[model samples]
Target: MIGSLFSRRRPPPMTLPDPAIVVPGITATYLRDDYPLPPEVIWRVLPFQKHFGSACLHPDDLRYEAREPALIRPGPLYEVAYKELIDELRYDLSPSPEAEVPVYPFAYDWRKPLDMIEADLDAFIDEVIERTVLTRHYYKDGYDCRRTVTLIGHSMGGLIIAGFLQATGGLRTRRRRTCPDHRVSKVISLASPFRGSFEAVVKMTTGTADLGLGASSSREREAARLTPALYHLLPSFDEGLEVPAPLPRTLFDPQVWQPSILRSIETFVARTSPITRTVRKRTEALFAGLLDQARTHRERLDAFRLDQAGLGPRDWLAVVGCGADTRTRLTIAALEDGPSFVLTSDDRRNTWPNGTDTGDGTVPFLGAEPSFLDRANLVCVTPDDYGYWELEDKALTRFGGGFHGILPNMNMLHRLIVRFVTGAPDPHQKTWGRPAPGVRPDAWDPPIPGLRNKAL
Candidate 1:
């Protein structure tokens, strides 16, 4: 009688539904592709001298040997967002058994070159094809050959996806592709710096930018200088974009750098200090190489002519963050001495041809958008509604307000993402190109919350 009274009730078993589409997610920078153990161990054993230890090791050598994680370790944002998506879709779509969405998270060393990242993504695509097409996973689940896989990318990951799409001819050439197995049906990008970021310029010049790394150590600063990927993040000045003219010249041509800064870099590069000189030489070489590469990469991207990439109306969607303070326009004046420099911004210059103010925290609202997307394919979300995701029938849905890092975890955003993946209609979503009603643009705030104090 006592045992019966204390008996616990068993919950119903979960019934997983057949996989309809395979969704793969790519993450942002500063994320550890492999577990942090080996590096952490090295850091622990190394002497903690200011700039004279293994801690000062650049990312290029360190990351190449780092092992890739079996699965992406979900962050706080991913945890909340993915959980909500799974719950909502399971209940809303009543398929045989519970709906099981096959989401494969791909990991890459964020410090590596873009071409290397693209190659990793390509390999991931091949792996997915092996699982779904070659193995009959799609056919077993009633998904026909016409069904295409979906890609979701955040931050720099979005750029990686774009490059992958271009290389694989997955954009407009999906239908014309000779290989049916590697087709991508749709792409969703969040806060991608397609045009570039002024923040990157700040980091390169000042050795400051909180790229999601925990603390700003001397080593972290040095690593930023050595990482080729950071240079790639600099502003791209193609036609139709209005950025500070001096900024691009400064980045591409070493001669344009302030004389003092250039001299300091040269001195550091030539230092005979046993510990720091090697690091400095590598950093200097990285700087020169990245400038040339940035120029070449920008030209290649411009040649792609994304606006004319031939994607269908529903093939692409870009979620833009707006109504927050973002660095849209920058003015750099060389100080009286060739070595000193001053940077300035005018909030009034927030629109195209003058400034860039509209954005989440890190990406300009305009920078988040691609030249090819008309009003229909863009969604603008503001800070007030930053975490909420409302679905719409049209291709774009904008949130009134939110920070860049917080977007992935918002419940509403998760729901909307689910709807897009499942091709659900949202009657309330706004028409393409039209801003949400009564949404006022907010004053300039730092892109990442709490970063104002840290990023100088």
Candidate 2:
């Protein structure tokens, strides 16, 4: 009797229905599969980063440094899969001929140098212009084509967005008779080190961290002696570069270990005074410059907000993944306290690590989003409760992992996209998590099927 009274029961899981494959309201004018697909009907034309460390050494032309991630290894099957899903979802968007398609133009290997990556930005932008121009005729006219576009980047893709946005005002391409509608609606970054990923900074700062950092170890040194010019530009040293092609589904690809590797690298760097000091010295100026650029972009957006120019309620969204049992005190506190109040850890002096003040282990609250948008536009969700499981229609319902790579998995995030694109709610009313304050449609309790009172 005593045990029964004290017992705690776990909540029953919520059941979801099959995904609804709705036919798109619009029709395509071009011969559906032929050249010049419309922008609205296109799924995603994603560009990936190559090895940064080897950019200078390779005999290949500099113009070709950036390669299609699909072209490399494992085939471009992922694009096919993504396209199928888009078809099923019935989104009218197509990859515009005018869409940007710039490659990293670095070495194929992971350890490419930072300077090499930095040097390629101008060329990359050129590629975006050229590709977008080449693809312009693909748009199937008269389908209420949206002027603005969305950018969904992962890993180095996130870095690309940062660099591209920085060059926005100054970077110009040859003007065309008619500029295709090239506006950016939203930037969706997955597992991105937005505020300069800690890994990037650690490697670039310390010459010893890994190939990504341009460090030479017994293993690397024993092999071909890479030139110092070649060493600094590539990112082959970092372990993250080890991820092989032929993408895997669900959660992180198992290659992306969190906090642990980062912690270990930090520990190693901390213990060796020589390495620490050297890295700090080397990276200070470069990091400062990068940070300054990011800040400038942030400032511009902030100013845009101050005057209520070019933005509206619920216009932007920032999504991040957190581990189970993670505490978001800093994030909650930041939200509650506003940006003016500085957040510090227990010692009062020790503040939450940079880039992740409000994030789980990787993302920070402020960096997760700029101050330009209303707080209500931002939403943080966890994988524990929402993993790629079905709640509504099976076709419609997908789950996401608890890891940081939550953005790629279509199953879990598809609903969000559907809602975002269609400007409608999931008919089932599944609850991914709480929305940031002051969002549209007013807040409603999202319910799950076969469950009462308890919502997802």
- The number of the candidate with the highest lDDT is 1
TM-score of 1: 0.66
Please give each candidate's TM-score. Answer: 0.66, 0.43
lDDT of 2 by residue, 1-456 (tens): 422221222222311111121111000001111122331111111222223222212212222222222121111222311343344333323223242222221111222232343345434444443343233232222111222334444434444444444435222343222323233444444433333322222232232321131333432221111222222222211222222233221111212223233333333334432444554333333323333433443334334441232323343334544332221222111132221112224211112222123343333333344344344444555444445352222332221112332334445455564455445544575535443322333542222111112112
Residues 1-456, candidate 1: write the lDDT tens digits. 422221222322223222222122222311322244442322210122122232222333433332223222212223322344445544554343433455555655555567677777777665564465333334444333333466777677677777666665653222422223435756667667766766666665565542332335444545455555666676664322333345454456554556544444444444422345466566456466767776666555545544343355465666666666676655445545543334545532334212335666567665565654554345555555532343331111222112565555445555555565555565654212223222322322212211111101
Task: Give all candidates' CA lDDT scores.
Answer: 0.48, 0.31
lDDT score of residue 143 within candidate 2: 11
Worst 10 residues of 2 by lDDT: 23-32
**Poorly placed runs, candidate 1 (over 4 Å):** 1-99, 134-137, 142-147, 171-182, 213-215, 237-250, 259-285, 305-310, 336-341, 344-356, 387-402, 427-456
